[model samples]
Target: MIRGRITGSVVSTRKLINLVGSKFMEVEYLRGGVSESLIAVDLVGAGIGEEVLVVTGSSSLRALEKDAPADAVIVGIID
Candidate 1:
């Protein structure tokens, strides 16, 4: 899992059927001295500015609904 903060959100009205009901958020992760953000499907409810845990690849795919087509997923929010 990767640690990141919720930066924004994504709205897709024409996404795949499997992903239609899922909420997507932008999360920023630090790499070296720089930080980058990516869109992650929300597995847990996370608000902007909140620290969260992200899962990617096969683990993310398995954590979501069957055949969710998610490359990344926000699994948890940190206090």
Candidate 2:
């Protein structure tokens, strides 16, 4: 899991069938003190500027409870 924060949202007019209803967010994570960003599917309801926990790889598919073309997903919102 990666610790990150939701910076913004992504709007797609077209996407894979499996990801049609998913909400995407731009997440910023710290890597060696350098900031990096990735687009993540939101499983939990997380808003901008919120701290979140993101899972990648197969874990992202599991979080969606189905097969998706997603490589990253927001699993939890940090307090």
Candidate 3:
């Protein structure tokens, strides 16, 4: 899992059939010294500016119920 902050969002009206009803967020990973950003599918209803826990690879696929062709997904939001 990667700890990150949701910095923004991605709105796509036209997506793959498998990704039709998913929400996308822009996250900046908060570990290490490097700041890396990625677009993540939001499985936990995380919003911009929230700290979130993200899962990647095959876990991302399961988190979103396989509706995700997503490589990264927000699995939890941290307070």
Candidate 4:
């Protein structure tokens, strides 16, 4: 898992069948106090500027496979 802050959102009209109804957000990856923005899938309802936890690899794949193609999935919203 990785810790990050939601930075923005992604909107796609033409996507794979699995990804039609999924929400995507851009997260600023964080380590300590530093961060770098990257894209992630939002299965959980996360808004921009919220802190969140992300899952990658097989865990991410499984979560994304539920509704869309996900390489990185938001697993939790952090307070």
Give a tens-digit lDDT track for model 2, residues 43-77.
88899999999998876776675667889999999
Best by TM-score: 1
Question: TM-score of each candidate?
Answer: 0.93, 0.92, 0.87, 0.82
Ordered by lDDT, highest first, the candidates read: 2, 1, 3, 4
Between candidates 1 and 2, name the one with more favorable TM-score: 1
Q: Give lDDT: candidate 1, residue 21.
A: 90
Candidate 1 C-alpha lDDT tens digits along 1-79: 8899998998989888998899999999998869888899987888999999999777787888887898899988987
Regions of model 1 farther than 4 Å from truth: none
Task: Point out the worst 10-residue segment of candidate 4 by lDDT.
Answer: 62-71
Clashes of each: 0, 0, 0, 2
Residue pairs in clash, model 1: none
**Comparison by TM-score, 3 against 4, better one:** 3
Off by over 4 Å in 3: none
- List per-prediction Cα lDDT, in the order shown: 0.89, 0.90, 0.85, 0.82
Q: Report the C-alpha lDDT of model 4 over 1-79, residue by residue, as the tens digit.
A: 8888898998989988877778889988866767677788887898998989999766787765655566788989987
Ranking by TM-score: 1, 2, 3, 4
Q: Report model 1's TM-score to 2 decimal places.
A: 0.93
lDDT score, candidate 2 = 0.90
Candidate 3, residues 1-79: lDDT per residue as tens digits?
A: 8999999988999778888888889999855798999889888878889999999887677666644477998888887
